[model samples]
Target: MSDRVALVWDDAFEAYDFGPQHPLKPIRVVLTVALVRACGLDALPNVSAVIPRSATRAELETIHDPAYIDAVERISREVADPYGNYGWGIGTGDDPAFAGMHDASARVAGASITAADAVWSNTVEHAFNPAGGLHHAMADHASGFCIYNDPAIAIRWLLDHGAARVAYIDVDVHHGDGVQAAFYVDPRVLTVSLHESGHFLFPGTGFPDEVGRGGAEGTKVNVSLPPYTYDDAYRAAFERVVPPLVEAFKPDVLVTQLGCDTHATDPLAHFALTTKTYRYLARALHDLAHSTAGGKWVATGGGGYQIYAVVPRAWTIYFAELAGGSTPTELPAEWVERARAEGARELPDSFDDHGVILPRGRREEVDERAAAAAQETVARVFPYFGLR
Candidate 1:
């Protein structure tokens, strides 16, 4: 297996931009690459920034409806979703019709598919597509700033290529509803999502009772963590849930959605994770990939609203861990200045985020909620996986 980790990127990826007012700003990605360069990850022998091809319509159709594809194409040309009857979740402010929307979304999916192909073909043991992981996207609709579900498409492609089993783990603050919905009844793909409880989050699904259907029971894991869940609570829940289920599933490949919005500084979401805690999560996932799937892992980027202070550092830690390099404690001063100039509201002196303080009388409720959610996942799904 090649030692290098494929880093999927292209100059046109910034075309996935929604607009300046959108919370899922493309500048976060730009700042991530900038920090990667400042830390010399792009130049690392173990990291290769591979250019990606835009996915063809056929590839996209593997996970999206043909009519939806046609709608996206039409919107790309018209620069607006004129037909509101498709019911594909277009024509909304969240998924505004932008110029080249189809091409850009396809490009993100293509990068993820290419990364999956590389890992499966043994061209690379691991790959990271920082531009991919549009997980909230349904098969036929755009939602949560995602036009197409890249992680789901990549997982489906793996199954179509004769892979017996694939395990998808999502760490986004929001539920990985799209990916879970994609493979809810398919035993070949196992999707595990750990996010802030849908009771308090957007899209408002991912309850424990919504496990996989039919033969895929216990295959779909959702850890609905409580609000204000700190690193210790989050880590405890994660360790209690993911590792055992992955071990039981014994997947041929591992795909992870590493969304950084769980950080306290993120403008969106309520998880209280620091960069130091994020490092542990990254390392654990990296190790899980090796231990569970013969070192085959495809990592994708997802929701993170803190473009300046949080995302750059969180993903820098992820990349550093994935590429077998030490994390840079402090960002370069020049890069910090440049990041601020480029609209990073608050850049960090170090990679670590300041810890979030839980207000008085909040700890018991938070811990109880966390404990219940974790127990719900373990209780509902572990027996099906034969771990109980």
Candidate 2:
């Protein structure tokens, strides 16, 4: 078996920009690559950078409607509004229709697909697409800054290629609604998401009760953590849920959306997690990929708005773990200089966040809410997996 790892990337991925004010900045991915290179992880003998081809219309149709694809294409040529008049979530505040929107979005989707293909074909045992993980996207519309649901499209590709089963685990702060919706009724695919409760988050839909509808009933699992969920609480909930279900599912390949927006400093989400949780998650997911999915893992970057201090470091930690290597203890001097050159501030000196200390009055409330959410979620979905 090929043990090499593929880093699916292309410079054109930076084209998926939504203007100067959008939180989902393309600089996050660019900084991630630069950090990885600076840390010399890119030079590892087992790691290889692979340029991706833009996903063709037919391939995108695997998860998006043809009409929606046409709309995106039509809107890409127009410059009247950053947000397109075209429906299907196009031209909205969250997902503005930018020039080359179709090509750029398709390329992001293609990176994930390329990662999936590399792992499935044994050209590589693992792959990471820092530009992919547009999970909030639905079949027909853009949502949550995602134009196409690359993770779902990639999972579908795995299914179409004769894989008996596939498991998707999304760790973004927001519910991975698009992916869950995509395979909600397909018995062959299992999607598990752990995120900030939909009650207080955008797209508000990832409750425990939203399990699959028919034969796929038990396959969809969600852990709706409360806001202010700290590193320990978040990891506790993850431990209680993800591993057992993924192991039980015994999927041929493992796919994950590693969005670091769960960081306490992220402007968009309320989760209080730190890079410690991110590192823990990376190690845990790495173990699961090896133990449950034969090391066939495809990982993608999702949401992380703290472009300088959080996103780049968190993803570099993730990539280091994905490659079975040690993470750098200190941020490289060259990377810090480059980040400053780009107008970044409060750049971290280390990979791990010091910690998140909640106010005295808020600690109890946060822990209580977190514990209740985790317990309720386990109670709601364990029976389906035959787990106590």
Candidate 3:
């Protein structure tokens, strides 16, 4: 297997924009790439960028409904309200239709598939499609600003290409309900998500009891955390659940969705994760990819709203780590200026804006709450994996 890693990217991915007001701005991806390049990560020998084509209907239909695909295409062409039987999650508040919605969403999906294909085919040891990870889209409908379930499509691609076991780990603040639902009954795909509890999140689903169904029982793992979870709490929750389960699954490929929206500065989420903690999580996941998946890993971007301050820095560090480069503590002034020119407010000078390090010092009550919650998750599901 090749030791190089491919970073799937193209400027055309910015066309995935919903609108100016939408929180899921495509500029975050742009800024992330820029930040990585500014930090000299693009020069790394292991990290090569690949442009992706739009996913064909056949490729998309592997995980999405054909009618839904048609609806997205038809709605993308219409100038007026084309709200017929089109399951166009279009015309809705979260997923407003754009002219090139199909092209953009399909390109993102294709990017994810290309990453997975690269890793699985031994073209690269690891791959990242930071523009992908629209994990909220279901087979039939779009939800939570996601139009195509890129991770699910990529997983399906892996399965079709002879992958025996693929483990999907989602660290987005919201549950990865779409990906889980897509493979709920398939034992070959193990979906593990650690997110804010469903009670306070959108597309509210990933409960402890919502483990995989039928033959896939015990394959679905979720650690639903309380609202005020900070760095240490987030790390503790992940440590308590993810490592043991992934070790047990012994996947042939590891797919991960790293959404920076869990940061406290994000406009949409309640989690308090700092960039330091996110870097630690990325490193941990990367190590796990080597340990459990033959170093075959595919990473993708998910929901992150703090475009200026959080998203760029968080994902830059992630890509750096993936490329085996050091995470720079300081942001390039030129990159910050470019981001401002692109309508983003100036970001902080350093990646560590919060001052608190990994295993943050939280209030005792919050720490206790997070610890108790982690214990509850392990108590509920660890035995299913025989991790006792």
Candidate 4:
């Protein structure tokens, strides 16, 4: 197996902009790549960035309707509002079509599909597309600032390329509802999502009881966390649920959605995760990939709006760890200045701002809730996986 990890990226990915006022700004991605360079992670031997092209229409049809694709393209070219028909959720406040909407969205999807292909083909043991993970887009509509469901497209690509039993785990603050819906009745793909409970979040779904449909019953897993869930609670829930299920599923490939919106510093969500905790989760998932899926892991970026304070630092450490490089204790001074110039006022001076080590002991109350919920989930689905 190759020790390298492919980092799928390109400057064109910045074209995926909703607008200047939208919270899901493309600057987060730009800053993330800059931070990776500032931390000297770009120089790591095992890491290299790959440019991606827009995905072909056929590849997009795997997860989206052909008519919707055509609508997006038409709106992109005409620069007119098709809000009545084509805008199931498009041209709305969350997903406004820009000049190159179709191409930009397809490029993000292509990056994810490229990463999936690299990992599945063993050209790289692990791959990451921090530009991807637009998981909120459904088969027919866009929602929650997501224009394309890249995770679903990548999983479909994996299945087409001779893989069976693919497992997808989503850690975005919002539920992976679109991806779940795409595979809800397919036993071949197991979708597990750990997110702030849909009761309090957008696209409100992903209830624990809503595990898969028909013959694919129990193939879907969800841990609907309570609001204000901090690092201890988050990690406790993950430790209690994720690993065991992946082991039971025993998938041939592991695809994960690593959204940083759960951070306490993020403006959009209520979860209170720290950067240290996020890094820990990334490292844990990387380890899980090696153990359960022969190191075939495709990681994607999801929702995160705290552009400077959280997203860049968190993702920098994540890519560093994935590249087998040591996390830097301090931020590069030049990067901090550039961020301030770019309108980030609260950027941290160092990557160690969190000042806490990972795998922090689980809190008693959080542990109890997580344990109880996990136990219930296992009981509900363990029989299906024949793990009882």
Candidate that scores best on lDDT: 2
Candidate 2 residue 2 C-alpha distance from true site, Å: 11
Candidate ordering by TM-score (highest first): 2, 1, 3, 4
Expressed as tens digits, the lDDT of each residue in 1-388 for candidate 3 is: 2258888999999899888888888888998999888998888877787877778889999988899988888788873642333455666778877788889899999999999988998988889999988999989988888888999999999999999999999999999999999999999998988888889888788877878889998888878887878887778878888888899999999999999888987888788778768878978999999999989999999989998888988888888778888766677878978998999755787866654433444546567877777777677767877876
Looking at model 1, which ten-residue stretch has the lowest summed lDDT? 79-88
Pairs in clash, predicted candidate 1: none
For every candidate, C-alpha RMSD to the true structure in Å = 1.8, 1.5, 2.3, 2.7
Taking all chains together, each candidate's TM-score versus the true structure is 0.96, 0.97, 0.95, 0.94
lDDT of 4: 0.83
lDDT of 4 by residue, 269-344 (tens): 7777788687788789888888999888898988898887888887877787778876667788888888888899
Maximum-TM-score candidate: 2
lDDT of 1: 0.85
Which residue pairs come into collision in candidate 2? Answer: 83-91, 84-91
The TM-score of predicted model 3 comes to 0.95
Task: For each candidate in the order shown, give its overall lDDT on alpha carbons.
Answer: 0.85, 0.89, 0.85, 0.83
Poorest 10 consecutive residues by lDDT, candidate 3:
79-88
Q: Tell how far residue 154 is off in model 3, in angstroms.
A: 0.3
Residue-wise C-alpha lDDT for candidate 2, range 313-388, written one tens digit per residue: 9999999887766667889999999999887978877878788898867877877777788788778878887897
